[model samples]
Structures are given as structure tokens and as C-alpha cells.
Target: MMTEPAQNTIIEQHINLDDVADLNDTNPLELLVQATGLSKQRVKDAMTKGAVWLSHGKQARPLRRKNARLRLGEELHLYYNEQVLSETVAKPELIADEGDYSVWNKPNGVWSQGSKWGDHCSISRLVEEHFDYNRQTYVVHRLDKAARGLLILAHNKEAAAALSAMFAKRTVEKHYLAWVNGQFPHDSITIDKPIDNKPAKSIVTLKEYDADKDRSLLSVQILTGRKHQIRIHLSSLGFPIIGDRLHGEPTQSQDLQLMAYKLDFQCPITGDKKAYQLKTWT
Candidate 1:
């Protein structure tokens, strides 16, 4: 059997080449050396190891070819995440493999997609690397960096668009589990608040309340996809999720006590109703 490769620690930083007028049309290697104050050979080594990236506005590409030219005002991003640079790979546990779409349990610390740094630690990249076929994977939805559990991906663009549409149309039902500080007032409550100037709704159900612990376990369902919707809504209710450092008061635990617990939706590609559940923090 083949052993999985070792994961690398990836470090990253960004440098803007906006004011370097003389560096226009100069070789990327030369500019990177000047920008980073590293030797040409060191810069070359970093580039060869897949650490250097070039960005033009929202589009970013890794620098691979030798003697690549740098356009004026282009951005160079250096990835120093040594963990990602190493052979260590993060393998996502595949839950179910549909023909056009699949479900996987996304663990905390794994990105849903690639960023300016690299794709090595991203779920999309990991999923693609897991398979040998030229077939690609597309992200249908995203789970937060600190949140865990059910994530769906599409094998092709058709499935991607369909699944994404389901989310946008509110045809998909998503439930999350969380532990919050203090006792909640209602057994089930709805939070209807505008998030980022967009309509956002959240339904929260109190599953359990421990008086001795002064904590409540909740099931949350979001009706809109807004950034930090659950965290913001729950905190607005004065019962912030435990371990949520950003929304709640800092606790000794650094792990966020939130997980995507269940999902129910019709398969846009197969036209079959589907449901999935994964118990977390129960």
C-alpha cells in the first residue's frame, strides 16, 4: 500500500509591486529578489517549490515557468506555509459519492477553497488530489474555517450550478449544532435581522439546557447565507456560542462549538430527495 504524503507547514505573505516603475518588464525572479531582499538563488528555490504567486486584481496564478516577466503594479504573494509545502496532505473523509455530487465531512482548519496563499490545504485541492482522474471538483457551498461537518461538492459544472441554485433558492435545509452560554428563553426562536444590509433569518431550537453548567445546546437553521450569520444572530440573542472567540467572550477553549449537523435537500442533478446527518458535540 502507498503511504500518504506528509503535510507541510505553509507560511504566506503579500507584496505589492505598485510603485516599482523601473521593475516593469523585469524578470519576476529579479523583482522578487529585490522586493524580498533575498538572494536570486533563494528566490528561485522558493519559486520552484511553488511558493511564489502573481496576482492581477482578483485573478491569481502561481509562478512556475522560468524567466517570467512582471508587469507594472502586479502583486507577488509569497507562501511560507511550510506545512503545505511539505508532503503532508489533508485527506477529507468522503461521506457519500453521488454520480454528479458528493458529501464529505469538513473538519475544522481546512479551507473550503484555495486563497492567495495556496490550494494545498484546501478541501477542493485535497479532493482533486484524492482522485487520479482528470475529473475536477467544484465547491457547492462553504463551511467556515473553524466550523466542522457536512460539505457538498460537485463533480462537474452542471451539478455545481444546480446545487448552488438550490442554496440560493432556499430549497436546501441546513441545520447546525452549537453550545451557547446561559439559558435560552424559548424552546424555539427565530431571529430575523438584516445582515450586511441583506435579509437574514435564523431559527434556533433549544435542545438541552444544563443548569449546573449554565450552558444550552441549540440547533440552528439559517434561511439566508450571510457572512457570520449564525454567530451574529446568536450573539444578538445575548447567548453567544461557546468557544466562538469572535462573537462571544473569549474562553479557555479555542475551538468553536459549532458544527453543521444536518442537511436536507433534493438532488438537483438526480431529482431525488436526499438527507444527511452527522452527530457532533452531542
Candidate 2:
């Protein structure tokens, strides 16, 4: 039994089944329970949330089943992040249910996909549980966890492939809203600066300006989807987003004033144009 100290952080532990000959036929849950001194219910929840893992010579992968038998040389790992497991995520609203795909208004702080820590707070996992796992859920696109708005979820693999291609090819028209500090200098501007040594472009237009608050609301469209593209571009232009802590000027509000407000694209399955928009900012 190897243990990583829980310094108010993720307590990682690895258990080798071969060492304890008597525990050879024991289930993964029991091993985790005895190793971590956590209750069975807590271990079960951790497994379901993707905090547990198994490895047998191959790469480690998340394990969710309790009854899975551990092989003689197999290893069971637990990443117990109490904070991640206890935090609650707001439910996303279903905007439209296309038979092949669906649109959802992901709330702020809800992740686009799951990490090794957990999946319950991710939109894709929520969609899977929403359908009772009857339909296969796939993530077609993603939004920043700090920024929330319309996101697409595919029910099957075919839809996922088609929609993913559209986004990769930049055929999908994406629109975003951001509130920035002070009055914007231009009505419209385009930034084509390379981000992370990758070609990325973002177009910004002044939507409205609040004279009293000295803030400007801007409309942003990205030609290439790069990580933090909009925030980086806007900050370079001198008007960082109001709450973009990473790339923007500091502000009182912790909530990021960014939203993926609209998405328009030709339906891959029906060949019909479809648009989804969120009036959250309006």
C-alpha cells in the first residue's frame, strides 16, 4: 500500500493486489475501502465520478465498477479529491433536442469534458445521466469552464464525427459576447496574432458601451478555435475581459463576462441549416 498525503489535496493511493495473497479475489471497492479508510458509499461515488483507476501493464484508465476483479499483478489507484467530489454544479438547460445531436446551455463552472478528477460536473456526463445512459453521449465541441453558453452534444458516434469535422474545418459560425473594461476604441477590429505558435484569428465589434460604468460590451467571432483565443486577443488590444483573471486585468467580480452566445451550422445528418442561441446576456 502506497499513500500520498492528503494535504487538503487529492489523496492518491496505489494498491498492489499481488502483495496481499489473501486479498487476491477481493473486489476493487473493498481494496480501496481498506486502503483509504473511506466508507464504501464514498468509494462507490468516487468510482462513478471517475476518480478510481486500474492498470495491468497497460495504461491506467478510469474504473467505475465495484465488482471488477483485480488480477494478481493488477494495480488499483484512487485519486481522492474531496473538494471536487463535494462541489455542486448547476444543471444545464436543454435548448433543443435534435434526434442526432442536442444543444445545451452549460452553466458557468461546468466543464466541457471530464478529467481524471471527476466527470459528474461535465456537460457530457450530465447528458449521459440525463438519458439514463440509454443513448451514447459524445462531446462534439467544448466551452471554457469559466465561460458558459450554448454547447453541442452528440448522441452517437456518427453525429460526433460529423459535427467535430465541421468545427475543425471552421464551417461552424460561432459568436461570443464579452464585457470589457473602459470604452472600446474601435467599432470593429480583427486580430490574427498567432497564439501558442498556432494561427488564430478573432474579430471583435463593439456591441454597446455603458458610459456610466465605463464598460463596453463586444461581440467576438473566432475563425480558429484556440485555447483562450478571445481573451488573449482582447487583452492585447488593451481592453481585457472584465473577469478574465488569467489574461485580463483584475476585477472585483470573479464571474467571467464571456459567453458563447450563438452557433450556426448546416446539420450534418439533415443537411439543413441549424442555429442555436442563448439570450443569457441579453
Candidate 3:
């Protein structure tokens, strides 16, 4: 028996199977119920939404299967985010509807995909809830939670594979609009820096400069998709993005001044060039 989790609780903990029970082989759901004191249904729901992970030694992987049997000394880690637990939900604005793939303008404060507890606060879960439960949604790429802009989601695995390959091959072009602190010297400058030991390149073109306010607007195009590449590259160059707390001084607004403005790629299913842009944030 289990009630609902409190709205403000965020759980991230690892529990070992050996510490909980003496059983040789037991399912993760049973262990989770014992570990978190959550109901069986609550544990099951968390696993289904990708809130759990299995770790043994140095190997850790997402635990999606509810009935997965645990080995001795293996740890079941639970991650529950409280932000999505709020009743408020952000809806994505549909930009285009291709048969195989769909483009949406994911709003700020919304996750591209859901976590264990934040499934309802994500675009991928919303698509599945509104469209068809039987239909599968695959995330081709991810957008920062604080950034608002154009995004694409694949409906099927085949389309997902092809679209993911497009990104991997660097055949896709992404354009972003960023608001930075201080005035940039060059109207056109390229930042070639290595992020996480991988080569990352970004071309920053000064779009609008407000010297009086010490603010600058830039049009950035990233040649490589590295984690926090744009923000890291710009911060290293002295002009940190305004409102970015992770890489720069935090602003009062707290809203990151970054937007995925445009995306260009060829439709893998139709063999036609496709380009999508959102003028809302620009």
C-alpha cells in the first residue's frame, strides 16, 4: 500500500540489494518498494518513466524494465525530480507535422524528455499522452531545459535512427540566438575550443550590440554538438551569456537568454530538404 509522493520531494539515492534482503534473486520493483517505502505501483511508475538506474561496479545503465531481476551487490538508484511534480505544465507549440517526424517549439521550463517523476512535464510524454499511447516517441536530440526553441521528435524507431544519424554525421545545421554580457569586439568571430577533450567550433556573429546597457545579441552557429559547448566557448572568450548561472554571473531575470532559432536538415523519409525556424524567441 502506498500513497502519492509529496510534491516537493526530490529523491536520488542508491540502495544495495544485499543490505535490504537476503534473497538470492528478486526483482528491482520489489527492492525499490522496500528501499523507498513507496508503493509497488509508485515504484513501477518510476521505472516505466526512466527514473531508476542499475549500477554494479563501474557499469550503470537506465533501468526501464519493471520486472528486471537484481544481482547481489547491485545497486538500484532512484532519481525523482520535484519540479515536474507541480500542477503547472508547459505546452509545446507545434511548428510542423511531417508524417515521420514532427517539429515543435518547446517552451522554456519544459524538459525535452521526461525523467522518472517529471514525465508529465516534458514534450515527449505530452506527445504520447495526447496522440497515442501505442505510438512510440524517440528523442533525436535534446534542448536545454531553460532554453526555448525549435525541436524535432521522431514518431518511430526507423525515423529515429535515420534522424539521429543525420545529427551524428554533422549534416544538420543549428542556429541559436544568445544574449551576452558586455560588448564583443568582432562582428564575426569563430571560437574553436575543445569541450570535454572533443573539438567544438562555434561561429558568433554580432547581431545587435547595446553598449549603453553593456549587452550584446549574437547569432551563433555550432559546428559540433558538445555538451554546453556554446555557453562554455563564449564564457571562455570573456562574454558570458546573460542570465546563465552555470557559466556566468546570475541575473535577476533568471531566464537564460538563449534560443534554438533555426534548424536545417534533409528529411530522411522524403528525401527533401527541410528547414524549420521559430520567430517567437528571435
Candidate 4:
């Protein structure tokens, strides 16, 4: 049976998963202490008990498993007893390019942007630091910090506007890899769903199968961008991605086997189609 923490001692905050980037690099226990004004031991105990909700991984245990080490560009949800707190941290290697756009391989656990207080480190800040002198960078789109993948950054307003338009028009093609719970149906399947007042399409291809675990590795191609579209759609299809705490069962592992492995689009500046592929796991 579960027991609740002290009512008066309980702390909670509904943090946007994207804002977690700010807390990267800092000790998770330390962050919790700072946020809740609690003792280090208290924070550590909660963490050891798996009270932390990470953006891309399973709920964490109180024990500081080495795998539980937080990284930049990741978001975290923390609860002390029953109180919740959230934070985002930035990546150290984020960069931007002169073509008006830059690409980043965002690891799971960070936020693309954040709220005030400059409390969380986010991809926007990571790019802002790279272009701090100009302060003109913009996020063309976002990747869930817990979902590792390729992210494109706009260096200037023009580039940002153009890329935003492209996404709105559904002209970009995005591909991802996910490790889902259960044997996938076939070689391929397409998910056509309306997402947030927009049309969303996804093509899933089976890549590998683990018979012992009854899980399938899939390559997901998205014809339209939507918040949690693939994760939600796949979960709706009864194959929720593993380690996805929000839409799937909680696992012992800390990493979600989902990666934005590929992206294809026409450059607004070059007027030519360009494709970027990243195989972080394959």
C-alpha cells in the first residue's frame, strides 16, 4: 500500500517537461533541495524511492542509480512527499549555423524552451548562449527533451519564420525510432490521426524484434508535427513506447528507446530539398 507524505510537508509543482533543461548539470538532489527548501537527505530519499518524473525515461527510484544521472537538455519532475517541482537544463555543446538554421541532437531529458525565472536550462537558452551577442535565435520546432532526436534551430527571424511556415504546411518529414512494449503487428503500419486541429500522419516500420521481451523496435516517420503525436498515436495503437511513464507503463530502466533519427525538408534559403539522418542507436 502507498502512503502519503505529511500534508503540510508536501510540495508539488506542475512543471512543463520542456523546462527541465535548466536543471541539467546540477545535482538532482541539490536541485530538489533548492526548489523545495528541504534537506538534502529528504530530497535524496524521495529520489531513491523513484519520486522523480523525467521527460523521456521511466519514473526514477530514490536511489541515485548511475543511470539516473541527469544530463543537459532534459526535463525533470520532482515530488517531495507529495509536493511537485520541475526543471529543465541546457546542453553544453549546442550550436547554431550561418545558413539561418542549426541542427542539434537533443538527448532525452531537456526542454526546448522554458518559463521565466531563467530557472531551467533549455535548448533556446543553449542557442541563446551560442548567439548571446545577437539574441536572434528561434526554435523552429521542438523535440520532447526525454525523446532524443535531431532538432533544427533558426539563427535569425527570417529563418525562424520560414521554418515555422514549413512546419505549419506539413512539408517536413520527420522520422523516429522507438522501442515499444509488445510484438509490433507487421513490417509497416501508417497512423493517420487528427492532432490538435491538424492532420497528422505517421509511417511505422519494424526494424528489430526481441522475442524474449515481446518488444519490437520501430522506425516512425511523421508527415506532420504535433505535440506528443507519435507517442500518443502509438500508445493509442496499443504499443506504447517503453519507459514512457506518461503514456505507457513504468519500467526499471531510465532511458526511453525513442530517437528522432531522421528529418527531411526543403531549405527555405537554398530552395533545395535537404535530408538529415541520425542513427544514434542503430
Q: Estimate each model's TM-score.
A: 0.74, 0.90, 0.74, 0.64
Instruction: Kindly give the stretch of ten consecutive residues in candidate 2 with the minimal lDDT sum.
Output: 1-10
Which sequence of candidate numbers ranks them by lDDT, best first? Answer: 2, 3, 1, 4
lDDT of 2 by residue, 83-192 (tens): 99887898888899998988998888999988878888999888888888888778888899999899999998899999899888899999999999799999899999
For each candidate, what is the lDDT?
0.79, 0.87, 0.81, 0.69
Task: For candidate 4, give the lDDT of residue 99.
Answer: 62
lDDT computed for candidate 2? 0.87
| Most accurate candidate by TM-score | 2
Backbone clash count for every predicted candidate, in the order shown: 19, 0, 0, 37
- Looking at model 1, residue 175 earns an lDDT score of 94
lDDT of 1 at 234: 95
Model 3 segments more than 4 A misplaced: 1-84, 132-134, 280-282
Better of 2 and 4 by TM-score: 2
RMSD for each of the candidates: 7.2, 2.8, 5.2, 12.4
- Candidate 3 is scored at a TM of 0.74
